[model samples]
Target: MNGAGTKRRIGIGIVGCGGIAQSHAAALKRLEQAGECTVVGCADLVEEKAKGLAEKFELPSWYADARRLIDRPDVEAITVCTNPPFHVPATLMAAERGKHTIVEKPMTMDLAEADRAIEATRKANVRFGVIFMRRFWPGAQRARKAIDDGKLGDRLILGDCILKWTRRQAYYRDPWRGTWAGENGAALVNQAVHALDMFLWLMAPAGQLETVYGKWANLTHPYIEAEDNAVAALRWANGALGVLSVSISTDPQLGARITVTGDKGATVSVTEHPEGRFGLNDVWTIPGEEEEMGRLYERELQEGREHFKPFPIAHFWQLQDFLAAIREGRDPLVTGEEGRRSIELIEAIRLSTESGAEVKLPLRTSTWVPPTRR
Candidate 1:
C-alpha cells in the first residue's frame, strides 16, 4: 500500500524484455532503491531475453511465458511492455489475477480493445493506467495549468503539433517496425500519437471532431510498407482549428513542438529537442506573464533535476503517479479511457485517408488501413 500513511512496498513485474522494457526496469530499480517498490518478476517469449533482463535488473525471477509471471505469488502489479499486439492480452491476464496493470501507449490496436481492457480492469477491481509520459513534462504541465486557469483566454484559436523525428531504414529492420499488422498505422499512429495526445490534452477529446483530412506518403524507405510522413488537418472539439504534421523522414530530426493560440492573442508553446532530452528547450510564454509562469516552470525543472535521472525523467514521474494512484485507491492520472482517446482520434484521421472524405467522430469504421504505396 503506497497510500498516504502506509509504507507497504508494491511488488512489481515487467512483462516484456524488449528495448523499451529497459526503461521500465531502470525506473523500477529507482523506485526499489527509494524503498517504494520491488521488481520481483520478468517475462519474455525468448527465455534468454527474459533471463538477461532479470540478471541486468537484479530481479529475482524470469519467465518465458507472461502467464508464469502473472501467476507468480509475489508480483502484486505488472507493467505490460509487450508489443502493441500483446498489450491487451498481457494486461487482461494481470487484471483478472487481481493485479494492478499499467499498459504502454496506443493502448491497444483500436478503441474496441481499449474499452475491453478498461471494462475488465473495472470488473476485477484493479487500478488501470496507460503510459503517456509526455504529459508529465514540466512545460506541458504549466501549459495545461494556464489553459485551465484561463491564462490563455476563453477560446483556443489555433494549435499545431510538429513532430519531426528521424529514423534510418535500419530502425525498421525488425519484423514489427514498419509492418501494417505488427506496428499498426505509420507516422500518425506510431510516432505522432504522443504529440497528438498532447494536442488533445491541451484541447480536450470530447465533442465533435470535424473536418479530418489526411494524406500519407512513403517518401523514403521503399523496403517498408508504412509511410514515413503524414499530414492531417482537423477541427478539435473546442472548435480550435489545427494542423498536425509528423514524420520520421527528416534528415536531422527537428524538435517535437506544440503551439496553442488563444482568442486573447496569447500563445503558449513548448519545444523539446530529441538531443536536449526531457527538459524543454523553449517554454515560450506570454511576455508579461513570464515572471509568474517562468518561476513555475523553473520549480518543475528543479524538482525534476533533483529527483530524476538525466534521460527519460518523464517516465519515472508518470510511474510515480501510477503508484500513488494505486496507493490512494484512485484512478491514475492517465486512465485507460483517456489513453484510448488519442487512438480514437488517430483512427479517425486514418479513416479519412482511407475514404478520401471527412470522417465523423465515434468512428463508424473499425477497419484499420495501413499506409501503403499508391
Candidate 2:
C-alpha cells in the first residue's frame, strides 16, 4: 500500500516499447508520483528496444518476450501498446495471467479478433479498456452533454467527419507501415481511426448507423500497398445522414473536424487543427452561447498548448480512469465493447469499398478483406 488510506498503487506492466509506449510510460510516471500505480516492467520482441524503454523509464525489469512480463506477480495490470495485429494476442496473454488490460486503438484489426479479446477478458474476470483518449477531452465531454441535454434539438439531421492530414514517404518505409498484412488498411484504419471513433461517439445520439457506402484509393502514394485516401457515406436508423472523408495525401495537413446539426437548426462541431493538437469546440450555435464559441476556443487552445507536451494529457486522464476502474472493481470508461463499435464501423466501410455496394450494418460476418491495390 503506497497511499495513506487502504488504497494501494496498482502494479503496471507495459507491452511494446514503441513510440506510443513512450506516452504510456510518461503518463504512468505521473500516476506513480500520485501514488496511483507503479510501472514494474516493460517488454518488446526486440531485446534492445525493451532494454531501452526500461532504462529510459527506470522500470524494474525488461524482457524480449511479453509473456515473461505478464507472468510477473507484481504486474496487476498491463497496457498493450503493440501494433493492431498483435493487440489481440497480448490482451489474451494478460487476461490469462489475470491482469487487467487496456489496448491501444483500432482495438484489434477486425471484428472477430475484437470479439475474441472481449470474451477472453470476460472469462478471466479482469477489467479491460481501449485507448480512445480524445473522449477524455473536456470539449468532447461538453459536446456530448449538449446532445444529451437536447440542446442540439430533437433530430440530428446531418453529421460530417473530415480528416485531411499528411504523411511522408518515409512513414511508409517501415515494413509494417503501408501493408495490408501489417496495418489492415491505411488512411481509414490507421491514421483516421481516431477521428472515426470521435465521429461515431459524437453521433451516437442520432441513432444506430444503418448502412455505409465507401471508396478508397492509393492516388498519391503509389509506392505503398494501402490506400492514402478514402471516403464514406453513412445513413442512420433514425434518418440522420453523414459523410466521412479521410486522406493523408494533402499538402498542408488540415487536421480533422466532426460536425453535427439537428432539426432545430443548431449545430456544434469539434476541430483538431493541425492534427495532433487537442480538439476544441470550434462551432457552437446552441442559442445564446453562440458568442461564447470564440472565447471557448481560445481558452481550450491555450490549455492544450500548455498541457499537451510530454504527450497529450488526455492519455493521462484515460489511464487514470483505467486504474480507478481496477481499484473500484468496475469497467473502464471506454470498455472493450465500446471500442469494438469503431472497428465494426471501419470494417463496414472497407467492405463497402471492396464490393462497390452499400453495406448494411451489424455486419453479418468478419470475412471482408482489404482491397488489393496495384
Candidate 3:
C-alpha cells in the first residue's frame, strides 16, 4: 500500500543467511503479507543456511552461491547481509543484474569500496538503501523533529554517546566476525555503528567533523584481531564537541544511549534498550519542553510497538520505505551516499588511533583498512 499498489508486487531475494538475515526475512514476510512484495528466493555461501532460511521464510528457491540468486529472473531486488568485505562485491553483482539492493550497515570495508558500490548502483539505475533502522525508531524521529523545529536552538554544544552491549567470546568464534579483515573493525564499526549513526543524525547541521582521536584495545577476546572497546572524541565544524564510546565487554549490557546538549539550554537523550528491554525508550527529555515532547514520544513509541510486535518495527518501516523508493523512482531513506557518513567517521577514528594524532575533516586518504593488530 505504501508503494505503487498491491497488484504490482516487487520480486525480492536475499543473500547471506546470517544472524541479521532473520530480521530481513521477517520484514520481507510482513511486507509480502501486506502485498507489496514477494520473497522469491535466497542464497548463502553455506548451502544449509540458504536452505534453512528459504524454508523458514517460505521462499521458493535457495542457492549455495549468491550469483545464482542474483541471476534469478524472479528476484528483482535483494538484501545483502554478508560480512563487511562481501557487501560491495555482492551489491555490485546485484546491480549488474539490474536488481535494487538493500545493504546491511557499515556499507563496506572502507570508503573506496563504498564509492565503488555507489557508482555501480548509479550506473545500473537501481535503488540502493542501507539498513540504518534506528532512523525509523519513534524516539529518534521525535528527536529529529525537535531539533529541526529549533527546539535545540541554533548550535549543538555537546553530544555524548555510549554503546555498552555485551557479546560473549563464543559470539566472535565465527571466523568472519571480530576480525579486522572480516568485519572491517570491531565495536565502533560493528556494534556501535547504530549509535554512531544516531549521534551523527541528531548532531546534523553541525556539518563536517574537524578532528577525531581515539584508542582501541582488545581487553577481552584476545583470539580476535579486533578491539573489544574504543573511545573517540570529535569536533564539528559548527563548534560542537562530541565523545563516543563503544564496548562489547559490558558485563550486563547497558544498551545504547546518546545525550545531546544545545547552547540554548535544551537537551535531548535517547536510550535504545534499557536493561535489555526491546524497543523501549528509557530516557527522552527536553529541559523546558519536557511535558509536551515526552507525551509525543510516548504516544509514537506505543503506536510503533502496537503496530509491529515480536519483530522490530523499525525494520518493517525501513523495508516499506525501500519498496516505496523503488516504486516512486527515488532514493530510499538511507541511500548509499548518506550511509557513507558513519563509515567516514569510523575511518577517522581508526586513523586517529593509528597515527596517535587528531585526524582532520574530509579525510585525506581512503586506503586505511581496519587495523589488523589485536
Candidate topping lDDT: 2
For model 1, give the 10-residue run with minimal summed lDDT.
Answer: 275-284
lDDT of 3 at 18: 83
Tell me model 2's lDDT, rounded to 2 decimals.
Answer: 0.88
What's the CA RMSD for each of the models? 2.9, 2.0, 2.6
1-374 per-residue lDDT for model 3 (tens digits) = 43554456889988899888998999989999998899988899999999999999898999999998889888889988887777888889889888999999888757877888899999999999998988887677767787788777788888998988887877776887877768777777788888888898888867787888887778987777777898999999989999998889885647788878787867787776543333334454556666776676577666655565578667889988998888878999899987888888888877778889998877634656554543
Clashes of 3: 0
- Indicate the TM-score of model 1: 0.91
Candidate 1, residues 20-86, lDDT tens digits: the string is 8988998888888877788898999999999999999899999999998889888888998887899
Candidate 2 scores a C-alpha RMSD against the true structure in Å of 2.0
Task: List the lowest-lDDT window of 10 residues for candidate 3.
Answer: 274-283
Scored by TM-score, the top model is 2
By lDDT, the candidates rank as 2, 3, 1
Residue lDDT tens for model 2, 259-349: 9888888888888887778889998999999778779889999988887874658999999999999998899999998888878887887
**Considering lDDT, which of the candidate structures 1 and 3 is the better prediction for this target?**
3
Provide the overall lDDT of each model, using Cα atoms, as 2-decimal numbers.
0.78, 0.88, 0.82
Off by over 4 Å in 1: 1-6, 205-208, 279-283, 291-311, 371-374
